[model samples]
Target: MFPTRAYSRDAEAIVALRDDLARWQVASGIVQWKPGEVTADQVRDQIAEQQWWLLRDDGAISATVRVLEDDPTIWDDLVAPGTGDALYVHGLMVRRTHRGRGLGGVMLEWVESRVRDAGRTTLRLDCAAANTSLRAYYVGLGFTELGEREFPPPYKTLARFEKPVG
Candidate 1:
C-alpha cells in the first residue's frame, strides 16, 4: 500500500502541492482550479482543522484530499450541513505526473475508510458542472450525481455526487 498520513506540521508541502495542482489545472484549461480558487491560508487551515491526508510514494507527494464533516455551502438543500450521513470531500487532486495511475481512487478509498470509522455512511463531493469528464469519472467510480446546484454569488454550477461508504 502507498504511504498515507493526516496533515501535520508541514504547511510548506501543503501549499506547494496546492500551488502545483492549481497552476497545472489553469494551464490545462480546467476552470475548476482557476486563480484564487484556493488560497495558502485555506490550505493551512485545512491542515490545521480538517481531516486532510497526504499520500507519498518514493519520497514524493502523489496526492492530497480533505474530508470535512459536512458541506453546507454546497449540500444544504439535500442534507443538513452538520448532521448528515455523508462526509464531504474537498481538495482531492493527484499530481500532474501521477494522473491515471489510480492514485485518486486510492485516496478516495482512504476517505471511505475514514468516514466509515466515523460512522458516516456516505461520501459526498461536488465538481464543476461543465466538467463532464470529471463527473463521468466519479460516476465510473460508483458515485451517483444528485443534480446541479446553484450558488448565491453566481459561481459556476456544481454537480453533487454521493457514494455509500461502509
Candidate 2:
C-alpha cells in the first residue's frame, strides 16, 4: 500500500507544492491553478478541517488530494447541499518528478476506497472545462462526464465527473 495520511500540519509544504504546480501550469499554458492563489492559511484551515491528505514517496510528499463530504459551492447544481451521497475530490496533484508512475490513479483509488468504506456511493470531481487531457484522464478512470457548470468571473466553466463506488 502507498503511504497515505490525513494532513496534520506543515501547511507551508502543501502551499509550496501548489504554487510550484501553478507556476508550471502558467508556463505550460495550462488553464489551471494560478500562481500564488493558494495561501498557507487556506491550506492550514483545510488541514484543520481534515479535508486534505498527503501521499508520500520515499519519505517525500509526492502527491496530495483533498476530499470533501460535499462541495455545494461547485456541485450544487447537480447535488444538493449536505446530500452526503457522494464524496468530492479536489486538488489531486502529483509532483512533476512523480508524474507518470500512476500516482494520480493511486491517490484517487485510495479516496474511492475511503468513500466506499464510508458508505458513500459516488466519487465526484471537477476540472477546468478547457483541460481536455485531464477530462480524458478522468473519463479513463471510470468517471462519467456529468456536465459543465459555469461559475463567476475569473473562474472558467468547470467540467464535473462522477464515478460510482460500492
Candidate 3:
C-alpha cells in the first residue's frame, strides 16, 4: 500500500518535491520553457498562502500541487466571471520513478477533498492546448473542458477545465 503525508510550508520535503517537479516538467516535455526558474521563495509564498501541498510516500515527496484561492487573470477570458467558488490547481506533478502507478488520480482525489473541506463547490485547472495527452488525463479524472485562450510569449494557448465537487 502507498502511504501519503502532507507537508507544510518551506519544509525540506517540499523543497525536494519542487526540485523533482522541475526535473519532471522538463523531461515530460510538458514544459518547453526553462526549468528550475520557479524559485523556492515563490513556492514558499504559495505554501504560506495555503495554496500548495506536497504529497509523500515512504518518506519521499512523490507529488506536488497548488490550490489557488483566486482564478488566474490569464483564464479570465475563457471561463465565466464569478467562478471563484472553485479552487484552481496548478503545478501538479508526479516523480518520474512513480509514473503510471495511479498516483495522479490519488493526488487529484486529494485535491478534490481539499476543495470540499474548504466548502468550495468546484475544482478548476488548465493545461497547455498543445498537450492533448495531458488534457485527456485531466478529462479522465472527471474534469470537463470549459474553454481555451491564447497567452503571448513563453506559453501559448491554454485549455481550461473544471469539475464540480460536493
Best candidate according to TM-score: 2
Candidate number of the best lDDT: 2
Q: Give the candidates in order of TM-score, highest first.
A: 2, 1, 3
What is the lDDT for 123 in model 1? 94
lDDT tens digits by residue: candidate 1, 10-119: 45666677778778767877756564556666667777785677887776678888888878888889987688588888878788789889988998888888788988
Clashes of each: 0, 0, 0
Better of 2 and 3 by TM-score: 2
lDDT of 1 at 65: 82
lDDT (Cα, tens digit) per residue for candidate 2, span 1-166 = 5635555566888888888998898898888789788888888888898888888767678999988998989988778899888999998889999889998999899999989999989999999998888999999999999899889977889999999998
Query: In what order do the candidates fall by lDDT, top score first?
Result: 2, 1, 3
**Over 4 Å off, model 1:** 6-9
* Candidate scoring better on lDDT of 2 and 3: 2
TM-score of each: 0.88, 0.95, 0.80
C-alpha lDDT (0 to 100) for residue 126 of candidate 3:
87
- The better candidate by lDDT, 1 or 2, is 2
Specify the poorest-scoring 10-residue window by lDDT in model 1: 2-11
